[model samples]
Target: MTKRAGSAGRPTKPLLKAPVRIGSVDARAVVGELRQLHEDAEDPDVERMPADDELFGALLYVEKHAHALRRQTPEVQRAAALRRVQLWEYVREQVDVHQMHAVDDARQAGAQWIELAPVLAVNAPSAAYNKAKRLKAVELTDETPQARPLRRTPEAVLRAERRIASERAAERQAQEVAQLRHELLVPVVERLLEQRESFESDEDIDYWWEEIEAVLPHCQTPLQMVSLRRYLDAVLRALAKIEKRTARPVALSEEALLALAAARKVRQLDASR
Candidate 1:
């Protein structure tokens, strides 16, 4: 049976924290990493914590939590618990004791907590951060910590990258062909629009009709019969029209008769001379 994880009816119930899964490595390896960080820290008396207070704060935090944090894997549950303890101590050491601007590193650790708490822990982010800080000081709430700034993402750039990668060679070819058509088709359309050239060039339709008819005398193919008969019928119709015009005399106008009479008088005058 496929077991569903979430409760069907009680949707509003928050998700619980879960353990982080370390790859190949186990819980002891992370303890070793934390130990190395703790062992290397310089004493506050010998050297003042660096002016870049956030770094010193984070380093100190890792040292303070190293013991409890050792057993914790980088996995969500353990890491969340470790961070909560560390942050709680840091905040308590602040408002309760010194209350002045002493060890004021809330923004650094708290902001980091806001960002990472969810991945580390598996519950609501605001609730987790609050719970983590409140364990030491009783005053923290869901709204107690200042909000973490939103990080920007290059979604458009990533989408473009994915689109280019996912496209097939045929799709690329189609885009190229479309772009080429736009470039080539526009000029052709403009030329036609201006009537710069005939729709069909004279060379395109120039029929070597005499050559076609010459083949008719020896034409023996079935396909040639239709062409031959069509051509001969056209020729016969043309000849019939020519003979009809030749057989009929055109009626002469009065102006033509007058011109003929004048030419006769001129011929008579030449004879007299």
Candidate 2:
């Protein structure tokens, strides 16, 4: 496929580089900004910044001066109350994220639900599992620091499980695709491009060359790079066929030959799958 005329580059900056103090005056705007961060990242499964350390520190400072805090104006008191609630919301989100991941890790490490139940402050194995699922559901649906309590219903848990599975699969695929590009596709493509003049006279390589050239610049992400795979595969096949059929095959540098060998192994794995 040809490159899109003006595709935007991948965002390099993280959603929240540092802990940000939420404004009590405009909760909705804060939520909107958070939502936009996720959108900007293309909804990748990645860890975000946890609760602000300073927020908790400030809370502790207030506690130490409790009598002085009580002497503050009603409006100031109301703002402090809002800030306290927002801090709790932030901490709650961090707790849910950590707890859900920790439970999964413990299970993967061969720990059972019965063992986890007491530690989770739940009555039974099923309760522990259900609680984790509920937390996962909350994580999947709600944006951070929600004004209202999270509605972690059973229905939401079911949906969250499905989303969790999808996100995991996408994450794995993106990683594998990136590995293939870096270790196999990129080096081989680089060698071929450097030897472009060698294939200029060959009619057989013209189509694949055009394809590779057009697609290379746009391979910025797994989603974009995925489409370039067919073209790469075609180039390998074309080159191999040319070597076999012609008495005078296009000469390859040692680097090109080695890169091609590594790339062929990846191709075999893909074909087997």
Candidate 3:
């Protein structure tokens, strides 16, 4: 009899394959999730919720993911470089389209390089200004065959544009003031030059007098109106000289004479409002 019955050997189970790890991950999302986990783990109240092991597990998971990302950094950079090149190609295409259109047409269609900069996402709004300058240089070179290449940073281009615009606005304002002065004073000056006996009528002189009066009320400084009145006095004196030289009788109305006298009496023009 033998020996005691041998214990049945435990049934063998088939070996299972390890789970496959992902080769790629979204770095931004992973970092954000890991940051949240770290915050939770460090919270004072977390001890009452998840145990120490759970907190440590979250940290370990993050560390492992970080290591994986570090290993894949070269590949990620390569992909990023490829994407940047593609985006620049798209920008060049847009530049070409802009160049093909007439300047006014491009402006009206919102296809100008400055306008296209935003859609291209080259950088911050203020930092994307160089595309227009660069495109313009390219066009000039193509046309002239030997034009020098232009290379300017976005910031430099922006500053230059602002300076040019301000200068243009100032020039336009000066031209407008010159035109206004011509309209208001030139005809009277011409009449004086021609040695006319008198103004066309009292109403003609009144029209100019009224214009000066209207401008005086809106003058920012007393000196501005004073200067205008001085100029008016000069014109009246010129007229008076012509009349005296021709030995003509006094033709100016009493009101015109009084106005001229008041202008001549102004000794100093004040800058005070």
Task: Go through the candidates in order and give each one's C-alpha lDDT.
Answer: 0.39, 0.62, 0.44
TM-score of each: 0.17, 0.44, 0.29
The number of the candidate with the highest lDDT is 2
Model 3 quality (TM-score): 0.29
**Better candidate by TM-score, 1 or 3:** 3
Candidate 2: tens digits of C-alpha lDDT, residues 1-273: 988976865563342232243323343443333333433434432123222334444445443443444454566556555655776676666667788899889999999999999999999999988787776654454334542233565555676567668889999997886666455666667666666665413665778878888878767766656656778788777877777778554445565555566667766776666
Ranking by lDDT: 2, 3, 1
Tens digit of lDDT per residue, candidate 3, span 1-273? 565675654343221222222323343444344444445445333233333334334334444433333434465535434433443444454454465354436557765456655665665534434554544433221112443222333443345456557878999997676446534443343333233233423444455445555554455454564555555664455545656777763345554454434433431221121
Model 1 residue runs over 4 Å out of place are: 1-167, 192-273
Candidate 1 residue lDDT tens string, 102-132? 2135444445545545643536666544444
Question: Model 3, residue 2: what's the lDDT?
Answer: 64
- Candidates 2 and 3 compared: the better one by TM-score is 2
- Tell me the RMSD of model 1 versus the true structure: 31.6
* Residue 204 of model 1, lDDT score: 17
